[model samples]
Target chain A: MWSWVAHRVTGMLIFVFLFAHVLDTALVRVSPEAYNTVISSYKNPIVGLGEAGLVAAVIFHAFNGVRVMLVDFWSQGPRYQRQMLWVVVGLWVVLFVPFLVRHLMHVFA
Target chain B: MSTIEAPRTQFRRSRATRSNYELWSWVFMRGSGLLLIALVFGHLLVNLVLGEGIKQVDFAFVAGKWASPFWQTWDLMMLWLAEIHGANGVRTIINDYAEKDRTRFALKTLLLASAGLILVLGTLVIFTFDPCPTGAATADVPSFCQTR
Candidate 1:
């Protein structure tokens, strides 16, 4: 139940970001100066933290989505749903920790 | 317990009345989810985790990437897939939450309109993009433009 909720929440958040991201990328077409001016804000510390959180949301959503697919398709999936959730968490930690470490360094640097 | 049907019962569903739109959407969600994992992870790794990370992202950086047909196709594919996937996800959410018929209809219409606009706009931007436009300060454009 919690997993489902998290999936929905994260999915919504990511979608929102995706919308804004497209707009930001579109700035490149306007002019190089316009694009660079906007993208520079992304390098600041606060937005950097937000970027970390955005990545966290994306990683969780991606891993949990695979779990949801497994539950629907795999024969033993339902039986191991709980265990699979744990696996999702484990994988998320594995991927996210490195991203956080690397990204924070760049952000703070 | 079997119950007899009333004379006016509409018991049979017409063979052609069923639509597989929802089923296809379900399949698409899973299939696209898998593809998005690869596309998005690569996007993040290249744009945010590599060399200067986000700091390296600027007009020149973008110009350099899109200058290659490979990254342009990669980003174009990513743009289309991610937008459609996101629009569908949000449509599901709107259906889940907006209980009233009018509210649901209004919200969905708005959602589709915006998503469609974004898709069209983003596509145009990608294909029509120029690394350097005449009359812009040379400093703002990619270095390659100087050779022209």
Candidate 2:
């Protein structure tokens, strides 16, 4: 159940990011100056936080993806699925902490 | 005395069918995942933390960065890795859960469609990005575009 939910959620998150990215890039067609204005808005501290959220989502999706792959292809994976899930959580914390710290410093300092 | 015979089911098990596609997919997931960690973080760091941070990001900003082969390659790698990784992951899910053959087929069809669409669109955007437009109001264009 968790796997199904995670799959759907991650898919949606990735799709959302892709949509935003495409739209942002399309701005270049409007005018470089206009594109610059939109890109500049990304500089905001709030937007920085939002980007961090995006990073987190991507990490989760990727890690959980690996987990799903293991279960699908390996005979032993189901035995360790729960353990692997925890490891993914651990890995996420390890990766995210430094990223968050650096982002905060850049935003506030 | 009576002799009894068992009937074979419709789904016959093939003993000799072998394909390395799954193995390659597995390897790709791990390899691309490791690369994604670095590429994604570096992307964030450069776009959001380096120099004047996100404020410096502009049309000219992208044009300047993409002007160099390094950034273009970086972006191209990221796009390919993430798209392939995510698509393969979804494929695994569809195989695992979608028991009905038609359902699995439909789901995978959709996944492939979306992935292919995104990949082509993204690649086009990255490679064909026009830093300068031929005709535009000067004030509405970046200074760099004017010079080109």
Candidate 3:
């Protein structure tokens, strides 16, 4: 139950980030002044924290997406669904450590 | 839950060989996801870890990145993959939860429109971004924008 919820919530979270990223990045086409003004606001601690949250969401969504792929593509995947979930968790942690360190360092620096 | 709970001796093997929307969607998720990992990680590494980290990601920084074909293609690919992947995922959620057909249709319609709008606008911006344009006042331009 939680896995389903987590997958959905993370998917939505990453989606929101994607939306904002595109819109903000598109500001480049509008005018340099507009783009610079908007992006400069992201320099603060609040947005840094939000970026950290986004990283977490991406980690979970990507790992779980692989798990979903496994279940969808592999004929025998459903039989080992429980095992696959554990593998996803393991992979998420392994992938996330470096990102965590980098983000924390930048946020506090 | 399947509306019909009857045990069917036959599976839709015939439909398996033919390419359809659902089939394409399934493949898209896996294929796009594989690409997304590379694109997203490269993006994070370049934008966040390289140079002065987040501090270096200002207007000129973005303008420079987009001026290159590589970053443009990368950003475009990321935009399409992430948006479609996200929209498809939400479509799944809607199908699972929305008992009323009308509600599901409305939600999906909204999702499709928003995703389409962003995809179009983002793609256009990526390809057409001009750091310095003709006839624009120097005062309103970014510091990096030199007068012609």
Q: Top TM-score: which candidate number?
A: 1
Alpha carbon lDDT at B128, candidate 1: 95
Compose the digit string of candidate 1's lDDT tens values, residues B39-140.
999999999988888888888888888888888888888888888888899999988889998999999899888889889988898899888887778777
> Each candidate's DockQ score against the native complex?
0.81, 0.34, 0.53
Candidate with best DockQ: 1
Docking class of 2: acceptable
TM-score of candidate 2 against the unseen true structure? 0.70
What Cα-based lDDT does every candidate model obtain? 0.90, 0.77, 0.81
Q: Mind giving the per-residue lDDT tens digits that candidate 1 earns over A1-102?
A: 999999999999988898899899999888788888888877789999999999999999999999999999999999999999999999999999999999
Runs of candidate 3 exceeding 4 Å displacement? A74-76, B1-19, B134-148
lDDT of 1 at A57: 96
Compose the digit string of candidate 3's lDDT tens values, residues B1-148. Answer: 4687469757664545545789788888899998998898899889887777787777667766876798989988998988999899889988999999899999999989889988999989987888566655565445566734
Query: Which 10-residue window of candidate 1 chain B scores lowest in summed lDDT?
Result: B9-18
